[model samples]
Target: MTLSPSETARYRRHLTLPELGPAGQERLKCARVLVVGSGGLGSPASLYLAAAGIGTLGIVDGDRVEPSNLHRQVLFETVDIGRLKAEAARERLLAINPEITVVAHAFTLRASNARELIERYDIVLDGTDRLSTRYLVNDACVLLRKPLITAAIHRFEGQAMSYVPGRGPCYRCLFPQAVEAVGESCADAGVLGVLPGVLGLIQATEAIKLATGIGEPLIGRLLTYDALSLRFAELPVSRRRECPVCAEHPRITALEDTAEACAADAPLSVRRLSATALRRLLVEARRSGPGLVLIDVREPWEFDAGHLEGARNIPLGELRGRLDDLAGEGPPIFVCRSGRRSLTACAIALQAGMAAPAHLEGGLLEWVAAIDPRLRLVAG
Candidate 1:
């Protein structure tokens, strides 16, 4: 394909590099890379790849842009909120470089369609937020024999690695066990605005380097970055002989739905207590001067209703950020309408290294049914 005058000018910087001369540039132009998740990491990685003239770019994201995303998702603005991320990304990328092709899939990457969708691209980039999606993306990439450049971000830290087919180590090799339930994600933890940008840029460099066959990639090395300490470390990763996915006696012949499995594998933070147990605790709280601190992890409106007499209100979304504000604890018990939000609260409190934080057996619903049936719980 012949480059137009504008494309020639746009990629002049890339043309100046010895490894990425006209031939390498052409290879990039001919590359087909599928990027999963058009969030933080995906935004920068896809933008750079498109600007670099990656011939065919496929962006898959099932989310819409939000006002909060503007801080780190550099591709979008306040005006782009409520728009499909993939569609918005495609428009911005094409406007930046009309020479390249950008395909957008504004749908979730689920088990039913992952395999077929992955097979269409030469390389895969995992920019997803959850563990389930990461496993799904990894498995799909391996099955399709596509190179995957994966990265994940947390509060002040993030990690990145590259997985090539029949190469050193895959994601499963490192994280063999199902990950433990996380207390808070980026949404709850409050990530540094520039952290994902730096990590995403690294991801983009890795993808471009892999596509152009330039530098030695991080195939068997895991790069960990700590923004707080301003430190970077690269740890070597080795393929596990006992890995279920890529082992000598591989158990997984085909892709499996890991979403539910991952959820099951993770240990729940708050264990279910019987109604009898809560009654005993309530008696204990009545006897003690400062009874157990019953915390409602639901929204504000839910707390407006009569709670366990003197319960505190702190929504689960803001729990991690407000941990320090909490008083010296008695046996802290968390509650929501159902048990789900309390479980998340338990996880976050535990991760924050809180002392003796517990959850209402089945949250406010259980509390209402067991202690006081007349109390009405409302949603905010």
Candidate 2:
């Protein structure tokens, strides 16, 4: 394909590069990339890919732009808050390069639509934060045999890798199963605003390399970046012989909804108690019952900074090991900075034979927001 006069002027710098000359530039223009999730990583990755002249870009996201997303998600403006992320991202990408086609999928990426959406794109970028979405994207890309560039950012650290199904390891090869205790999200744990920008750009760079066949992609290797220490490490990874998705006798022949995978490790017997209901339960227990034991499952540092008064500290990591401590305590009410860890804790308690253990609905955040605004809230 030949570049138009306007296209030549626009991509003059890229065309000037010997490694990515006219031929490579044309290849990029013919590439169709789908970026799932218009959050932190997707923001920069999609922006750079569009500016680099990817012919067609597909954006998938079901969420709306919140004020909190503005710190790192550069695709939306202050005026765009409350707009659907996919729509906002499409507008921003078009604003960056009107020559490129931007397709907006203003809905969640689920098992039912993942394969169909992925089949239309030459490459897929996994920028989602949820574990379920990550696994879903990976499985879909693997099944469809499409190149996937995936990256994640947590606080000041980030990691990224590229997966090309027969070329090297898939995501499941690296993480055979979902982690039992999922880590806190950017909202709960707090992330440096520029961290995802750094990681997303790397993912974009890898995607471009894959499209243009210019540089060696990150297949069979994981690149980790630590912003606090300013270190970059490339760890070698290998394909697992027993990988369920890519193995000789693949177990997961069809796609499944993995949205609940994060909570799969938790026991099914535990029940959820809203913040208000928990307060009432605590009051009634204090008057008539044996009394309620409110356990804060956050780390000691988080509890020290600020926590619900009268709650005992027991980190989630230590909960399974220290089941003896709560042996004779009243019906346990697990809490955390967010509700996730506490829910995991409640599951642990139930699995360990504790009867009728419950977790605060939205953890301490909801408790403070609904029951006691006077309490200081700390991010996990």
Candidate 3:
């Protein structure tokens, strides 16, 4: 399709580039990119892709904006807190580039609808945060033979990679099986607010490169970024001959939900206790029995910042060795910045034969949100 007068004026800088000339711009104008998740990573990714003139941009998200999201999810404003993310993102993208078509799939991407949604787009961008969703997206992209640009962020680091079906390694090739231990999300681990913006823009760059056929994308390689150190590293990835998906004779011919897989890997004894419930437990124990032991599993630095008044600090890595130290204490409640490391601590306590220890449902984050609004929930 030929560029219109307004489009030419809008993309004059991109058109003038030797690598991505008018023809490349036309390719971008004809591309259909689907971004799954309108959260931190998806926010900047969709914005830049829309600004770059991707013909049709589809955003899939079932969540509504929250006040907490305002820090990193740049697509929405304070007024948009209760609004659906996909819808809000569409409005924002259209305001930025009215010429492009923005489609909002304001629902969660599930195995039942993943193939249908992904097949509609030329390329898929994995902006979702869950391990189950990431695996599902990877398997679907591999089976449908679609290019996928994926990115993930934790506290101070993030990684991005591209999977071009037969051209490079799929996500499963690099990670043969899901590691639930390392699956802590930004919500759980506490991410640097600006980290996703940097990584999301990188995802946008790779998508644009794939659409415009520009410089070599991060296919078959993982690009990792460290926000604290400000360092970028590229790690080579090789296709596994025995990979369940994208192999010579693939074992997985159909899509499978990864919820069961993740669940199977999770510890059975790790139970979640909401902040209100924990507070009640403490109150009840204090009234009639020995008080409950509240253990803060975050590092000393995190503990020094702010923690529950009576909570004892026991970092997760040191919890295993200190199991005997808490043998005779009341039922322990593990807490962390988010709840991830606390869950690990609970598991460790249980493995050491501690009875029914639980982690804070959302860690100290929930505590700050529910029990004590005055406490500051710091993000790393």
Candidate 4:
């Protein structure tokens, strides 16, 4: 991982630093990073990562540049509008640093190829706009145990976070469900244009920190920026014990084709109900059943085995369609095996404009332990 003469001169500024001297420069030369999407956020992120001398930089984008993209996507010029984004970004990044190897993955990241694509790299920088693709990258990284630096933009504001395998929370731990275009798209909402540049820079910084093993990465904290107010905020996050993909008994053990991401990304919002309190609510609801509904979001067999008395079955996958059934039925309470799927259900309900939706905290396992152990239900 020794640096050549050209690399030495190229990264002269980095080499002069105390912490990131020759050793850090060499680590950057040895690092392999995949930058997913070369659009708004990916644009500045890829540029800096290349400028910083990431040894093998890969760009994954399946989009064609357009005239509108020129204003924000710094990787493309007017002449490159018709070109593929991955190829275009590869050329731009390489032109910036020919000393580094650039790999172009000119295809969409899908369930079929996510693992293989992500497995090839030491770290992943996800600056994708599509919510589904974002989740796909997150799950694949968590499964592969690779470090992922992810960011998102909405209007004049942006956010960034990092996920290091077996160390901190995954994106799903922060946002456990894929919400549809509930007012999330930049095309529809309009972006400040320069907003993503800030977040993308943050993504690049985190990747370099992770690669060079230097500055503390945003592993368990979410970094947010507000353009109008010029404020940067950090929110501490913790891994959910019932997280669908990273938990003890993950309900979503496999990757499936998520629907086309027409929805915009939303903030994390879910209410939790303790087992002891829910039992009282169930008793109260039995007399006046219209104000509240208990939803069991699990497999039919799991529900049939044992669930809270008076709970209705509506598995998490089908929770979207069943949302309408509960219309005017009052704000519902969702339950699942280990509280994972139920949290997803709560998020879905909130996205659908329903009243505040809540999940049984810790799921039925908590109910069994805290209230009724004789219920004969086991944690899956």
The lDDT of each candidate is: 0.77, 0.82, 0.82, 0.83
Q: Which window of ten consecutive residues has the lowest lDDT sum in model 3?
A: 260-269
lDDT of 4 by residue, 1-380 (tens): 78888888889999999999999999998999999999998999999999999999999999999999988998899999899999989998999989889999999999998888888999999988888898888889888889999988877777889999999999989787776655435587677889889999989999999998997889888776778878775656679787889897888777767987632346433445778778888778778745468899998888888877778999877988878899868778899877767866777787787756777766788888899987756545
Ranking by TM-score: 4, 2, 3, 1
- For every candidate structure, what is the RMSD over all alpha carbons to the true structure, in angstroms? 15.6, 12.6, 12.5, 8.8
Residue 152 Cα positional deviation in candidate 3, in Å, after optimal superposition: 0.7
**Cα lDDT for residue 332, candidate 1:** 66
- For lDDT, candidate 1 versus 2, the one ahead is 2
Q: Candidate 3: where are CA atoms >4 Å away?
A: 181-186, 260-380
lDDT of 1 at 68: 90
* Steric collisions counted per model: 0, 0, 0, 4
- Clash count (model 2, backbone only): 0
Candidate 4, after superposition: displacement of residue 286 in Å?
A: 34
lDDT of 2 by residue, 12-87 (tens): 9999999999999999999999999999999999999999999989999999999999999999899999999999
Q: What is the TM-score of each candidate against the true structure?
A: 0.68, 0.69, 0.69, 0.73
RMSD of 4: 8.8
Q: Which predicted model would earn the best TM-score?
A: 4
* Tens digit of per-residue lDDT, candidate 3, span 282-305: 788778866668899888887888
